[model samples]
Target chain A: MHEFSLCEGIIDAITAQTCQQGFSRVRRVWLEIGALANVELDALRFAFEVVREDTIAASAELDIITLPGRAWCLNCAQTIAVGELYDPCPLCGGYQWRLTGGNEMRIKELEVE
Target chain B: MCATCGCGETEPVIHPHDHAPDHAHPHQHDHAHDTRRISLEQDILAKNAGFAASNRRLFVEQGVLALNLVSSPGSGKTALLSRTVQILRDEFPVAVIGGDQQTANDAERIIAAGAPAVQINTGKGCHLDAHGIGHALERLALPKGGVLFIENVGNLVCPADFDLGEAAKVVILSVTEGEDKPLKYPNMFAAAKLMLLNKTDLLPHVEFDVDRCLDYARRVNRELDILQLSARTGEGMEPWLEWLRRGRHDALIQQINQLEADLAAARSRLIHGGGAIRRTVI
Candidate 1:
């Protein structure tokens, strides 16, 4: 799965931060994953655990925050909240929807020493 | 123990008594370390995105129209790329960065077709990330106004998530595959802007429903541009070639437009500052 590669990216980012922030051990990580980011939470957790082995975050706890998906409905002329990319507009039942939000995966904070 | 060389025969260093807590907790622990909270607020994919941005900048600087070609394992990507290179190599300089799990066969094929090519054998990587492509760019001498085709590892899933700094992701689907490939792999179809339905020459011999396939692809990406072609028989190659020409033309136009805007801004600044302002060509 791509989760392993994504976790590699996360670890690289964290390692880079450790150099600039002067931290040796990371105890916890808080991540914000959007609904439409196309990442499976369990898969990410598994990947993170495997990737963090023997690193600064070996015993770190992962905290995940999910964001909702938002899209623009062309027919309804309004912004609508969607749960998936292929969903139709809830207000007008139209498929002419454009994605607007909830397509992000970011690390928000870290507890380190 | 000495910090320099831990021989375990030195006096142990201890913290001052004042630094110790007054009382131990109900569930006491030996390690009493103070943790610090740091606010990062950074995208996890920032590293990849940074590489991608740099690749895009390099492409613009070189006026190279880069395209990432993706498809299943046997979707005729190499053939189409070879054919495209053979036909257009005389007109414009072209290069290729072929990705695969092993072997340099595709790169060799592209080279034989009369184009500069390099093979990136990803040991275990399913898709070509931006960082890999950036390294490949270092090895390739892509001329200005040339085309760089990056043939990704034959995967329709993982490549959908990675940004390779291409002008567009072109998915090539052959007639031998299922017509509902777009529906099955929606992410790939959704990410691609163009779908080349290759192997049209075999349409009569095979039971591939062209209309149904297009319908399924359109269902996922309504704005996708579809081109039917057969790299084997040179049928319907004009549209595909035209598409490449247009991409290069559009990139040139964009560069000209940016230079003109930069010039205008520089002129205004010079007019206001009595010729002391420096010109910025971004």
Candidate 2:
């Protein structure tokens, strides 16, 4: 699954930060994943458990902050909440909207010792 | 105990009464082990994005029309590429980079069809990232002013997340599959710019609704271009080929515009007598 790949990236980023910050271990990791990012939360947690072994984040707790999907509806001229990429504007039932938020996968903060 | 050097000393002696209240300890002591929170706010895919940006720069400099073809297993992506290569090779330079988990059969097929091809065997990776594509580009010469088709690993989910710096992503769907595939895999459909309804020759044999499939695809991505074609029977291939030709023409125009801009900048530098004469070799 792509969640595994994303986990690898997470570990890599953590390892690099460890080197720069001179931290021996990561106690917790906080991530910001968007609703429209196409990532399954359960799968990501499972992948993180499998990928964190013997690394700096071996005993780290993963904290995922899910961001809601938001888009600018061209027809309604307002920002609307969307659940998926193919979702239509709820107000106008139009497909002419541009995604303004969500679809992001970022490492926000870390608890290190 | 000193875990760092393994000195086997179980404890360290600290004399707090010998030091003043304002004195700082020079060695380890029994103090609170504080855990610090570091705010990073970094993108997880930043490394891959960097590589993809470089690949995009290389393609634009060479005027290559790179298309990433993604689909599910047994979607006849290789067959379509073989046919497309055979037809397009006569007009301009064409190359392919095929990604599979185990075999090089797709690359061999494209080579046999009269175009250079390279096969990337991603043993455990579900999709080809931009880093792998950069390494593959080093092994194969870019087809300037032509087409470089990157046949991504036959996966509908993972490939939608990785961008290989292609001009467009073309998803191939054969009629043998379900018509509701677009709705089932909305992310892949939404990411793709075009969808090729391949294996049309089997449409009559299979109970596939072409209109229904198109409608579903539109519901997912309203701007996605669709084409019905069969690589085996050579039906509806002309329109697909024409689309590729148009893309190549646009890439060539972009290259010309970039060159003209660079020339104008150099001419202005010369007119202003800025620094020594520097000749740019293209």
Candidate 3:
């Protein structure tokens, strides 16, 4: 799964930060993943456990913060919460809408010693 | 007090601190081992984005129209690419980079179609990242002022996240598949600029609803351009070829404009008598 690849990226970022910040070990990692980011949280957690072995974050706990999907409805002229990309606008039942949020995958912070 | 050996002595020891600190020592260290929270707030895909930016620059400089073809397995991506190459090879240079989990059969097929092709075996990777494409570019000569097709691994989910510095992502859907595929895999359809409805020859044999499929795709991505074609029968290929030709032309024109702007900037520097005139070779 691509979650493994994403985990590799996360580990790379952590290792690079550790080198610069001079941290000996990572105790926890915080991630901000959007609902529409197409990432399975369970899969990501499993991949993180596998990818963090022997690294700075070997025993680090993963903390994920999920963001809700939001979009701007063109017809309704209002911001609406969308669960999926193909979903119609709830108010107008129209397909014309622009996604405004809930597509981000970022490393928010890390607890290190 | 002897904190290192824990000798249970109340008086301070006069020994040098040359020995390693034992686990029992709590406060004998020079620095505090306090845990600190650092705010990074960085995108996880930043590394891949950097590579993709460089690849984009290279494509612009060389005026190469790079298109990433993404789809599910058995969507006839290889067949469509081979046929497209055969038709466009004579007009302009055409090259392909095929990605698969295993064999190089797709690359061989493309080569047989009379164009240079490179096959990237991703092994366990479900998608091709920009870093892999950068390495592949080194192995294959770029088709300057022409089309470079990056046939991504036949996957709909993961490939939607990785950017390979393509001009646009083209998603292929066959009639044999469900009409609600876009609704199921919205991320892939949403990321694509164009969607090709392939295997139209089997539409009559199969109970596929073309209108309903298009509607579902549009709901996912309103701006997605749709085209119906069958790679096997060579039907509705002209329109796809025309789209490619237009894209290549636009890329070349943009390159020319950039070069002209550079030349104008150099002229202004020369007139102003600026120090150290830097000539940018194309």
Candidate 4:
């Protein structure tokens, strides 16, 4: 699955950070998942566990925070609550939208000791 | 300002009266009227991008030419790739990195076409990634001066955004598919460097308009080369095969130059930092 590739990226990111910080162990990992990123949180956690067995993050706790998907309706010129990639504005029902915020998936920070 | 209606000019504020706090002197959750901002600046895919860049560099250093083939199901991608391998195998060493949802059918077909083939089962994944291709390269047993063709899963929409470090990306649309495909799936056309309008043999009976299709492809990607050919009848295949041969030849030369450069860099680095490194993967 492409999930594995994405997992590989996560592993690489964690490993790179650990190496840079000169940390030998990682106890906890903080991750922010975007609702519109098309990534499954459980699958990501599972992949982390599977790939971390021989790495520094083997026993790391993956703390995931989900950000809701939102969009800025072009017609209304205001942000709206939306759930999908193609969403119509509640105010004007316009298809054209400039995604303003809430779609973010990143390793916000790490906890290592 | 309110994000939804822009009616609430001031941000919402909540105090201790909004919730009853536990009498515990210190609490994890504290009700406050202060507003805060979360500043997220790092990309989630930052790490993936690093590895991808390294893989691209490796390909460049090895003088390896790569291609990603994307098309819809039943568009004859595998068949066309098979023909591509057959036609060019004797001319030069070629290999294939075949991607599919769950079957070894395409790999088997590619191997039968008389070249090395590696199958990547994406499970439920819809597209192929650079890391997947990197892993496949380990088992592909490809040789120097080799051109690896990646046959992506049959979909036009999802695969365009992911870059597999391909030197060239080709979009194959058969005559059976309507001409509007270019306009409908402009992303694929925009990403690809070559467009193969395959199954030209059926043009006589099919409603596909080649002129309109070419025009649409040009409209989307003005620089993309449009090749119309029927791999079955061998009609219009000469130019296609020739183009493939020339491109691969140039790619091989480029790879040789890269390997030479890498070798030189390793030699100089060894003088400064002594270490043993493997030269040939084969």
Ranking under lDDT, best-scoring first? 3, 2, 1, 4
- In terms of TM-score, which candidate is stronger, 1 or 2? 2
* Tens digits of lDDT, candidate 3, B1-282: 233223224332223334654535343346767788999999989878888988888898999999999999999999999999999999999999999999999999999999999999999889998977887887899999999999999999999999988999999999999999999999999999999999999987999999999999999999999999999999999999999999999999988987898899988878786434444431
Q: What TM-score fits each model? A: 0.84, 0.87, 0.89, 0.62
Interface RMSD of each: 7.7, 6.8, 6.9, 11.7
lDDT for residue B190 in candidate 3, whole number 0-100: 97
Give the CA lDDT, 0 to 100, for residue B105 in model 3: 98
Which prediction has more favorable TM-score, 1 or 4?
A: 1
What are the candidates' individual DockQ scores?
A: 0.42, 0.52, 0.57, 0.11
State the interface C-alpha RMSD of candidate 1.
7.7
Give the whole-model CA lDDT for all candidates, comma-separated: 0.85, 0.87, 0.90, 0.73
User: For model 4, which pairs clash?
Assistant: B63-B255
Q: Pick the candidate with the highest TM-score.
A: 3
Quick one: best lDDT, which candidate? 3
Q: State the weakest 10-residue window (summed lDDT) of model 1 chain B.
A: B7-16
Measure candidate 4: CA RMSD.
Answer: 14.3
Winner of 3 and 4 under lDDT:
3
Which residue pairs does candidate 3 place in steric collision? Answer: B1-B12
Which predicted model would earn the best DockQ? 3
Per TM-score, what order, best first? 3, 2, 1, 4
Q: Candidate 3 — what's its lDDT?
A: 0.90
